[model samples]
Target: MIGLTGSPYGSSFPYAREGSFYLSGYKGAAIWFAPVPLFDHSGVVSTFRQLELTKTKFGSIIKLHLLSLALLIVFSFIFYALIWKLAPIPSGAYPFVEKMWPLQATMETIWIKSTLPGGADVVGRLIRWEYISAGMVFTTLLYGGLMVLKAPPLLFYGLIAGLGTGAWIHYTLPTFIGAMLGKFYFSKKYGEKRWRAYAPVILAGYGCGLGLIGMAAVSLVLIAKSTSQILF
Candidate 1:
């Protein structure tokens, strides 16, 4: 829904984040920028939605919204049905759809957050049920307003990164900075085209490495839990 509303190609990192299922690390990269959002701050709603709210295409938006909702319900039913048929988990436990699921925006989908070893329920069922998004709404308004004021993208990006760090939302900004430095260093030494060609491969490999590291983390967590259980 996010990618459908915001983008069709899933080219931007934000778009890919909105639609992570499309850009699995081993397969490919699609990181292109669109200029439309700079001018038209339509936010996450479908074009139909924009039209409806603005009194341009009300019925169509309602139809489209209902259609999208129906498809989602159907797809969800089919997915769970298949899971029950093929690889059923024990009663009351959900399977971990690991790897890239964590990298996605929480607003985009409902996900189960489970702690390894302890199997604690960090997020049960839907992370959110309502369509009303206070945080996204605020950020969208803030961003649109800032853009009107001629705010530099990187300036606000850095500010958000700093604030996110303070709020314990780590990982993305550091990697983004590291990638920028790597780009500069390599582009300066080699050619821009050469670095551009190799950058995707390097990052893809790094992503796989991170996955392995996550597995190691799971192992360590289990070991620590077991040791603690034994000791105390």
Candidate 2:
């Protein structure tokens, strides 16, 4: 049995014990393991110290990224509120629109539909729309927040990297997979319907546009970082 032990004052696990272990080291200063020697004690301690340093650096990076994300979320929320409040009101049949509609339109499919389909559908649609809208709003807000937050250049670059990752994983790949699935599953069912036949093409085009936007945003962010550094 290999047992792990951590430093009381540090985050690193510096000691490992085997079955029937009973060992001692410098009191309150170093850790000890007994019964089986899996590694050199001094070497293990050094390695643990290096790992601790690395972990500290990584933690700093994560904290910076999270700060940027939060800033983006707040900015996005404010932007959404402003847009919703300043936009024109719909007349007659259209109901009062909320601040989250733009985000919902981009992320939620049910909200894309014009007429209500059936029972409890409105409630379900609203819930999904709110959840997705919140996510989109959060991501978009973070993109702008990084600049205002005075984050490190690397942090801004990381945000762009994350956006690129999201565009490919969330938008482009899904669009491709959705198109393939539609062709495989619905081609036979709706082959004669012109709208159905063209749906995939339209979706693919939308995905391409979104992907291009994401790429442009990434390039702009990188360029801004470089220019700022050069000017300063």
**Highest lDDT among the candidates is held by which one?**
1
Q: Write the per-residue lDDT of candidate 1 for residues 1-232, one digit (tens) a residue.
A: 1243222322223333323432232222222222223333445456656576788766776798899999999988975675555433542223354533454545222211232223333333324535337656866787788899997655455545444443344665676677688777888887889888888798799999999999898657545533523455
Reference-based TM-score of each model: 0.30, 0.20
* Model 2 whole-model lDDT (C-alpha atoms): 0.51
Q: What are the lDDT scores of the predictions, listed in order?
A: 0.53, 0.51
Error (Å) of candidate 2 at residue 10 is 42
Which residue pairs in model 1 clash with each other? Answer: none
RMSD in angstroms between candidate 2 and the native structure over all alpha carbons: 25.9
